[model samples]
Target: MAEAVRHVQVIAAQCTAMGPLSQLEKAARELHDALTDPMLGGCQARTGEYPSLLIGDDLTPQDIDKAVDAVVRQAKADGAVLVLALLGHGFTPPQRTDLYFMVRNSTTQSLRSAVDVGRLITEAADEPGIDGVIAIVDTCHAAGGVPDAGRLAGGVRAGRSRLAILTAAAADQPARDMCLSLSLARTLKDGVPGAGPALYIDRTLAETLRDQVSGQVIGRAEYDQDPFPLEGLWLARNPSNIANAHADVVGPLGLQDLSQSVDMWRGPRRSPGRLTRSTLLELEKFISCGRVDDELDSASRAWVDDVVTALLEVFRTKEFLADVLAGSLTSDLLRSAGRLAGFPSRAEGTVPLRDLLEYAVLRAQPLDGAPWKGLARFVAALLHEAGISHVDPRLQEWARRLHLVTEVNDAFGEFAEARQRRALRLVVSLVGAWTEWPEEVDAWLLHGSADLPLHQRFPCEPGGAHGVAQAIGAAMMWARRELPHPELLEHVDIAAPAHLLARWYPEEEKVGRYLLGAKYSVIPRWSGRLDEAEDNAEINDAARKALKKMSSCAAAPVEWIDSDALLDRSALEYRLSTGQYDAAIGVDHSPDDLEEVLELLLPFAPIVLWPRSGTRPDQDQLRGLVQERWHELPDGLAAAYRHRWGAHQHCVACLGDIRTVWHDEGWLEFCRPFEYRVVTTPEEEA
Candidate 1:
């Protein structure tokens, strides 16, 4: 039996009286043209070649209903997919909030006379023979009744039927004239080739349209049933004969050919002949003359593919590879090849071998015998040899593909275990150089816990901390090396301490106690003692003189806490309880007591707490303390106190200037007075 033909009905119910809705008529015409065009395989209408029954302003309410009903009946009888496109002005009547599509004679007050879009869609879904329905509404507030329409459409659970509803705007947003219709018509006309042979337009195309139009004109689509059956349903073949003719270019040339050619040029390690300068110059000339065809015909596109393949063959030569690696004239040829292969092509005076290798790995087609693995390995070796410590996204991708860390470890198999650890350290250091902390470190730290005292485990020289105090000491050393200015020490929040502590002591309570001790005890107490020493006239004079002699030296003076002072349990308790860090430090304390105090405090001292200056002990006393201990105090604490005090003073002076602007603009309900709260610190309670 011969199947009946499908039908498409486009109804443009434009209200001519509404000034803004004139574009709806044009949109309807464009949609009709797009649907009926032979390029898109739209059904030819019975009356003529055009494939739409457009219901324009001339159609009355009864005429529109009859026209729509007739189309639905015909579509059902034919067992065809019904495409319904509506372009008009929509309105929510004041008597009721439900939205309606205004017919030619319909008024805002008489919305009942207008088309009930939901009821119409429900009728279409009720038809048993109609397998699919595509309903598009291009009007202001088109989505207002979509939810109800969707529910009604799902009422009839007939055989293998699906309903797709597309709205020009979201329920809350207004639809602009011509925007949705034009974009959709364009997409349907041209078709998205990359999405395969499916006539089914997905959300990706909607997103593309949204990006092209104003944000307010965004469109939405909903399906009442599974859309899988629509996949690979062809609405139109490629209109461009040129694209059709050259579709097989990439397949025939094959990525394997390029990979094999490159391998031949690389040659065996024993074969030592290098590429000549003249050959490189000839390659460069060829690239300069090799132009990409803009016409996009089969012949032009095929020419481009051939030129790229030929360039790849030239790059395979060992001499050319050496010249490129050595920053010789062949670098231009490499850059040109990258451009031809559709990689980022920018002219470079000198191209690094690593970049060329990365480009090859990125552009190589996914095929058997492609040199992606070899190229990745070559790039990794170059990076290692060049001592390049920074990590890039491309390098990260290569690392994943090549299993970089594992390969690096395997390469050092001939060396001792200690040497292998050292080699891993280089890789870790490079990773750390780019990121503040790399996740790779967590695995390495866990696996190599026995070898904890290596340089890789600590941030400072002769690295490795035996305990909390040694870790704090290592952090301080790192601060001195990295931060030349004494003021910068306060800003240095040592992340390594917390990270190491978490791994070393996974228990929550133990980690908390250690962090608290480090935060309160070690930093503030040691900082206070340093302040007291700096205030001494004789020591200050001597330190200033010593500093002048070696102005460029990276090293800073170290203040060693006595072991007895650090170990004093009573003193540590007092400091923690009263927050009086200075009371715990003294020359009278023995080395053992100092060590105990340090052991107690090292865990908490990593995080420094700055006191609120506005509500602290007397303002005059605080200022005096700051001036005396400015250099010894951490930069973060100092800056916080300074900014707080300054802000408080500013607020007090500016209170009179606070005026409510909207109160004078006739918004009487919004004229409300507000008050500010005073900030207080813990020291104020003490």
Candidate 2:
């Protein structure tokens, strides 16, 4: 295991814009040197990365954004003690809601033109995975950056932000030039006089920095709300000979100031790392894409409590895991964790539990659909056999996050990811009457969730049976250029409003002309749902239900709404939205009558299929085919068509109106803003 790095990152920013303020520059430089001192906890700013913000006449929000993002990201760790020392003037905008680090070009109206310290410091202070913060703000209204008490520890359990904030003055007052920064530097460089062996932030250091400040100083820490108070932070070593004499003796090795001597003994430093909530969330979404889950519904939050509990158990006894999970595959899987990603250094043997957990999460988290032959595969297999296969892929992610499992199972995971034929999503959206050629609408052939969609605009003459087919043909031709194996596409999911669904679309590929309708298994979804906010509770719940119901494909069919039941739209909406229904079949409704079909069913029912406008095939055969090929979904829809298209009467029912929807709400979530789960690979520090 790597030695813990107490001060993981040191960032000191000053906004002396037009011309440099010599005193602020000197203080910020001194603070950086003090924090990076080997004796004052090991933080080495040797990555050629600047330790201070480079503000000037040319400064822009973009520059500040990159600098702040890089620094805070580097400090992501459960053991990290981040030292944020700012020497700028803190200016709260008119509303006094957002505090900005004022520069020569800064203003209140356009926040983008200024460095909003609230966005920069206040928010970053409470982010998960940061163990502690020692913020020394030396600007006017410095107290503005201090978050409300207990706010840091409120949202999460184990990854709580416990920190001591020391500011130059009260929220309404002005600050003395560089007083707080200089005081912290001096206190750290020269140990606290007559203090304990290790300096703690809240009690000792806060008082020291406060006394050194010219005027009143404000300090805040969240210890009152912390369930298990963090261990005393070794921020600085105490050199007081008198204080040491009365202290419980350890040995002569406890040095007051090892400024010049410590480097001679300690080996080269390797940075300590912990998975942040954002990175873990991204990994969860990446794995859960195109997958279904159940609704015990812990999906909304990270399972920090679980991993912490497991780590505690591992600490009690190495063999305790085996005893707890006697017959299960969990113990057998964890036995392989020693060989997993290095929680610092890789090896196979007895190791500390904390390192083991970190390694388990770090190694197993694949940011893309790329094949990762790691512990996730085995854990996923174990979960599948427990009677809930693919029921909430997050379960596999969270459980393994709590820690590990055995060797590669390429058969299941590899084929699903690598050899797996990716989807070619075709979307049709109504433009409304405001645009020219009202029938001239938008269509997209999506390559992947992250890839830019290929778009084309064309008018589909209403009731023009060939209009939808011609549009599909054009998209197919364009899509084939991109696919390495053009022949490998299983089927296409057409997402459209009811008018478009009312028409029949034929598939005319180079292979031959065959009615594509034989293949579609409509899964309802609306493009507008993508516009809804992430915090939309109603949509989020409905989407989760849709994702959860995907597994019901294998279970016996529960209920399907028919034409008579679908007539009363309100009644149908209530039944479907509140309860889980597998499919919605409309046998007699015309395209005009079905205008509101998607709006009502979308995001609720996983599958919705209505046959061609004219034909009403035998209901028994249609239901049987749906039940038989339910699990594979849109892909399976094609297989059912190929097996029964035309030769049997059920073929018309299966293929004629099958160009339906498979509106995987999870797909929408990932594509629109995957937000945290962007395609960018995480810069995880090992």
Candidate 3:
């Protein structure tokens, strides 16, 4: 009898509803083409070879059921490995909720909910030839958020077989649509072996072969049944990793297998005294970059040890001091060197005390003025290594005085504009209690002496001593009344309270009003009283509001563009929710005409042509429109559109509007309406 036919199904179901469609079809077509190309992952087998089947279909209740049944039947009949690629909706709602998948059904014209997916497990548990199952879920569960580990673990348990469930995101993380699958496609077309370095995975055939070599080890673990000769199995985010796993699992398929030859796959070249000085130099660079991972190869670990030894030797040398002062060496490496400076400072050494404070200063100077603030926290680690008490009065004072918290805040602001101030607040909260701070820091937040530049700064608004008093009072009341520790606020001085209560500053009020009217407001809650837990969140919301107002007011008004009638209002609103508007328009302009609308929306916009259908756009016309526009788009936008537009239907903000356009391009140009403010000078507007 012929062996079970190998099967691969890459489901590019972008639709969360059974209504109008666009990118779902495109993704399906792309998956279909990928499956047909044998050079991709489709391989011919020997002796009753298992044939491969690729399924690219929209996900619906009925569709999901059929898919489940088809996969189960194929697994039983072929006794072959199975691969399922799912790209759609999945996420955890607020308050640690269960993640859910959106399954659509067109006959009923509605979305179906698929919870605790069980097809693969049921078939593996029931069949004979089926080696194992590999399932990949690339979608947010709810509100574009990932479920927690507890939920994923529970889902795995529900499968009840030799099953492997892999998600694109961690349980508590949200998944994003493939950001550059087409650009990756072009790279793949150029014949790059394995999957290109794209943002997401979609090599269906390779995944199938990968399953063949790895066998049912993952599923066996799930079933609590380990068989003989354990096969290698892995969960990876990159396609190249899967390809590497494939070669590792198969192991010398033909005459290539030579018993006498050395095992290159066993890791590194085994040679006596392999730790050379040259290798040690390279190791120093890697460690300084914070590239140390627990998953390093044996050779790598040995090399790291050698480098650590060399670093220690350098620190002991007088010549190293000159280099440190000249800004040629890093403080982090210097600290590491300091730790290794003593005879016991080598990789295997046990140095009790090292001058890490000096090390931090040295490192900070060279790294463009302490570029990453997280490195400052290494001081604590150095102290711990030296066996110093973290709670020591001297240590706490030192920690607070480092100004590392502010440094970290600045770093976060550099990384993300929307969350900049909030990130700063979080850093302060996290590291405020450190010991090394001067009394002047708190004194600045209180009353300051006249003519003293630092003294004029206060924790609350300027010239609002009353506001500061009110904030202190409210913080104390809330701590005493609502929080877990009433004495907490008492312990916390007026320098930095857990929360603050102050009347909205005029500028702040203006920003908030503009945001309150915008479709995608930055403020999370409009009417709620500010409290301790909500303080940071409130700040972020206010900043977002202010930014929008400033952007909108600064842009010179163009009379030709009708602000109210620009682009489909619903589509524009959807675009706003996804942060797409910010990307395409900048803070300068809005898309009021078809050309601008098409320019911004076409790249990632999934066309929903409306006919006689209720909410869904007309099917045939929509398909034609998308097919026609697919190749006409600009290259950059096309790449971006293909990457982020798929699998956004049924999103909380989507509201099942079929004729909708969701723009997710990173248009950071358009001035936002909430950013508007009265300015005294043109320079201020500029």
Candidate No. with top lDDT: 2
lDDT for 296 (candidate 2): 38
lDDT for each residue of candidate 2 in 412-462, tens digit (9 for 90 to 100):
354345323455455544333221223444556665543677776656554
User: Any idea how many clashes model 3 has?
Assistant: 53
lDDT of 3 by residue, 565-649 (tens): 3535575546444533221121112222333343333322112111111233332323323222322222122222222234643
Q: Which stretches of candidate 2 lie over 4 Å from their true place?
A: 1-3, 7-19, 49-58, 77-79, 95-98, 108-110, 149-159, 216-230, 241-686
Candidate 2 lDDT (Cα, 0 to 1): 0.46
Residue ranges of candidate 3 with Cα displaced over 4 Å: 1-5, 14-21, 43-59, 91-97, 105-112, 118-129, 142-166, 170-177, 180-686
Please tell me which model should have the higher TM-score, number 1 or number 2.
2
Query: Highest TM-score among the candidates is held by which one?
Result: 2
TM-score of 3: 0.26
How close is each model in CA RMSD to the real structure? Answer: 28.3, 21.6, 24.0
Q: List model 1 lDDT by residue over 66-143, tens digit each.
A: 667656755654445677777887776554445577777777667667887766766776576565677777777777
Q: CA lDDT, every prediction? A: 0.41, 0.46, 0.31
